[model samples]
Target: MITRSERTLNYAVLVLFSVIALFPVLLILSTALSPDEIGAGGSALSLEFGNFAEAWEQGNFGSYMRTSVIVAVSVVTLATLFSVMAGYAFGTMQFRGSEVIFYLILLGIMVPAEALVVALYFDLRSVGLTNTLVAIVMPQVAQSVAFGTFWMRAYFRSSSREVVEAARLDGAGHWRTLWRVLVPMGRPAITTMIVLMFMWTWNEFLIPLVMATDESLRTAPLGLAFFQGQYTAGTSLLAAGAVLVALPVVVVYLFLQRHFIRGMVEGVAK
Candidate 1:
């Protein structure tokens, strides 16, 4: 049904946007591989693979990467579990004040994290959690859970009621139905949520900057900032560090892109 002109126009737009998005990434890769420091003209193309090794050692990225992985994994795991449960209840079960409670939780998605971060910092400090991984992980977990619950609730609400009835008829209780029936069928949505949460938690900067004063506890992005500040003259190293920090996210997305896209499309349609 589509005209040739329309198809061409769509391809043109996609190519344009793709270039816009990829230009910076290509520049970074170029800079990272250049032997000389990047300048206004950007780094010259070369095959300096040693830049990554140098950046890794100089930036102390190993510890930062380890910390980031731990925090991201912990936050995503806890947030997904909690969000699935809360979303199921809100989507399927009726109880007193349930709407009110769900609305209150939804307030979290409405509010910006920047607005609450200052107060959250003070609250964590009061509890002696500042300068700790727990401080960063906890806030991000809460934030991720807010969005995850909202996302999963929509999925659950749109799920087939006949399936739930069948599960009940098979003597499956609510817990068993959720874990055995719903969860298995919800792989696309669940994987999408996990990927989203992982990216957010991995890329988080402000909370870690505010909460983590100890060098050992800094996340990869925070460490990259410090590395940038210290190695302003080492352009290749800086670009390499940036790539290293971003690699995990890129790798994860590539692996789960199919499920991620499917989940997003289905969620939107529902």
Candidate 2:
């Protein structure tokens, strides 16, 4: 229904915004590759790729990355599983107090984490979980599950009634109907949730900061903070470290971009 000029204008606006958003990323990448060593400089784009290596070694990013991967993977897996089951129940089944409980769960998303993190630290400490990876991961899982439940519930609620009725008529029980049918059909929504959870878990900072006192339990962002302090004068190294910290999130989004975008657009349309 749109005219050609309108479409062209829309594309131009999108391109302009894309470039504006990407400028900072490009600037960081350029600085990360810029020559840091003395007497080895040519242009700003000298392509001193060793800066990443030097930063990695100096920053002890390997350990930080491992911890982040562990926390991220654990939080995402547990949160996604729980969210799917909870969303399925809330979306499809009827029960007493269901609305009340669902709204209570929604409070987890509504409440600011900063408000609860201090108390949460003490609660975990009472259980002897402080300074452990469990402490770092559990809170994030709880947080992600809240939003994931909301996300998946919306998807399932609006899913095809005919498809669900057909599955029931085929003698499929709830479990079979969910895993064998609806879950498979909800791949885009699920993938979107997974990507989001992974990014959030990977980048979480405050929870890890409050929970972990041990150096080995530090997540990438926490490590990056320390790395920044240590390398205050080393701009190239700091830029490279930033890139390293962000690379996993970028890779994940790139890998799941199609499903993520489709899910977002569909959710909006519905």
Candidate 3:
């Protein structure tokens, strides 16, 4: 019962917003492609593919990227596994003080890292974990678990009880029921959670900055900040570095976008 004019208007509005959101990305890409002398405002007619190489080498992004990958992968894997177990428990099963324990974990989501980073630094330092991969990965895992538990819990809560009951009737244990059944069925939701956790873990700055003083321990975003300060006059290099730091997350999202969108829509619908 929609009119053609209304549909057209909606399309026009969507196009406008899309362009607005994409503008900064386009600008950064253009600037990254521009020559050093011409800077950000310069034309991309002269595409400088070498800017990325120069940025990569000069910024030591090879090391930063490796660190980011290690941290992100570790955090995502741990957080997702823990989140699934916790979410499945909270969403499908009941136990003593379950609500209370779940609410306590939820506090992590509400608390800002800025408020805890200083204290967290002392805690890690006391344990002699500062400047170590464990320091970087563990805190992020905890942070991610908070939100991941919440996300997966929603999906599990609204999951098909009939399927679960059937699994039980088939003599499938909780472990079998989860891995053999619900996990496969909940792919979209789990994938969405992975993408989100990867993004957040990859981009985290404050905790990495405070906990690690080792140059090799710097995450991509922290490296970018230092790279920016060092390359204040090198706009092309800065833009290229920005793109490099962001490319992994972009690639991840692009690959998982279908599942990501489906999960979001389903979550909302449910």
lDDT per prediction? 0.85, 0.84, 0.86
What is the model-wide C-alpha lDDT for candidate 3? 0.86
What overall lDDT, based on C-alpha atoms, would model 2 receive against the true structure? 0.84
Question: Per-residue alpha-carbon lDDT of model 2 for 1-270, expressed as tens digits?
Answer: 899999999999999999999999999898888877543565544457677776777668878888998898899999999999999999988999989999888877767679879998888889898999888888888888888888888988988989999999999998999999999999878988888778778878898888878888888999888788876654887888889999998987888887657655653411
Which candidate wins on lDDT?
Answer: 3
Q: Across residues 24-123, which tens digit of lDDT does each residue of candidate 1 receive?
A: 9999988887774343333343247677776778668878898998999899999999999999999998999988888777777767779878999998
Off by over 4 Å in 3: 1-16, 38-47, 258-270
- Candidate 3 per-residue lDDT, tens place, 13-87, comes to 999999999999999998888788644544454357878887778768888898999999899999999999999
Give the distance in Å from residue 63's predicted Cα in candidate 2 to where it truly belongs.
Answer: 1.3
**Candidate 1 residue 245 C-alpha distance from true site, Å:** 0.9
Q: Considering every candidate listed, which one attains the maximal TM-score?
A: 1
Clashes of each: 0, 0, 0
Candidates 2 and 3: which is better by TM-score? 3
Error of 3 at 7 (Å): 7.1
TM-score of 1: 0.87
